[model samples]
Target: MGEVEIRPPRPEEYAVAGEVTVLAYQADGHLADGVGYDATLRDVARRVEAAEVLVAVDRAGDVVGTVTIVQPGSEYAEISRPGELEFRMLAVAPSARGRGIGDALVGAVFDRARALGLRRVVLSSLDRMHSAHRLYERLGFARLAERDWRPFPHVMLIAYQIDV
Candidate 1:
């Protein structure tokens, strides 16, 4: 991998970008084989229409990571308030992990929030995603325990936030 470009994916790359997101989640054990949520994760087209979807493409233009930025009223936003931006479905290909791709993706989220003049950025993560929690903390996000909630049975999501 040479330089990575973080930007909205080209329309032709939607399927591949969606597949990369699903692969990353499955590889990380955050998503199970044959789960219905896989469909949601792979629906990049829907996300593109409802929010800002960004991809981290390698020098060869292959998408290795992706994330969705959701405004307050979007269907994907779990806990964003007025004057805040929320991001969801952050994923980086397993082969591309440990290369600062995740950091870059989250950084891009902050950039988006700032560019939009939002006062903060928020996100939710599963408890099992310890590594992701570390990344968020390293990026100055604080735990928002009060905002934690379970979106589904047997699955609890924790919240984190950072003021821009």
Candidate 2:
């Protein structure tokens, strides 16, 4: 880990959303399942004004990871608890995977979550990604439930929640 700095996403950093989305979710042949990375990036852009986004920048100031913190609303109606914050999109570039960039991005969320006095943080992750599941567990997130989700062929939708 070479000085990973996690900070709030700025207006200019929005330009990296699409590229990051593609790297985070796309290029995985098994998980493609007809989902559109472009649409996800657009949603991220649209929610930027209301959502809390954290980006991981290396010592050189290049973004290597990102995590979006979404609050409850009609936008996040799936979340039953209004006081909960969702760790929606968490991603670390392939090259930065083992360097603690993901941990830094997630830590930024926890820092903000504590300041806001949030009750819990929730997230949905695909079950196929076992390593990611381990990472979330290592961060103290426990499995809440698993269900079938939309936009993909995967039937296992593991949801996790962590109390603040």
| Model 2 lDDT tens row, 1-164 | 35787877667777675467557665443236565545665355665766777778788878778877877773643453677778776877676678877777777777777888887887877767677788889999888875235445544567888888
TM-score of 2: 0.84
RMSD of each: 1.7, 2.5
Stretches of candidate 1 above 4 Å error?
33-35
- Residue 88 CA displacement from its true place in model 1, Å: 0.4
lDDT of 1 by residue, 19-127 (tens): 9988988887887533488898889999998899999999877899999999998888899889999999999998888989998999899899999999999999988
Quantify all predictions' global Cα lDDT against the true fold.
0.90, 0.71
The runs of at least 3 residues in candidate 2 whose Cα sits more than 4 Å from the true structure, single-residue gaps closed, are 27-31, 42-44, 74-77, 146-155
Best TM-score goes to which candidate? 1
Q: Which ten residues in a row have the lowest lDDT in candidate 2?
A: 146-155
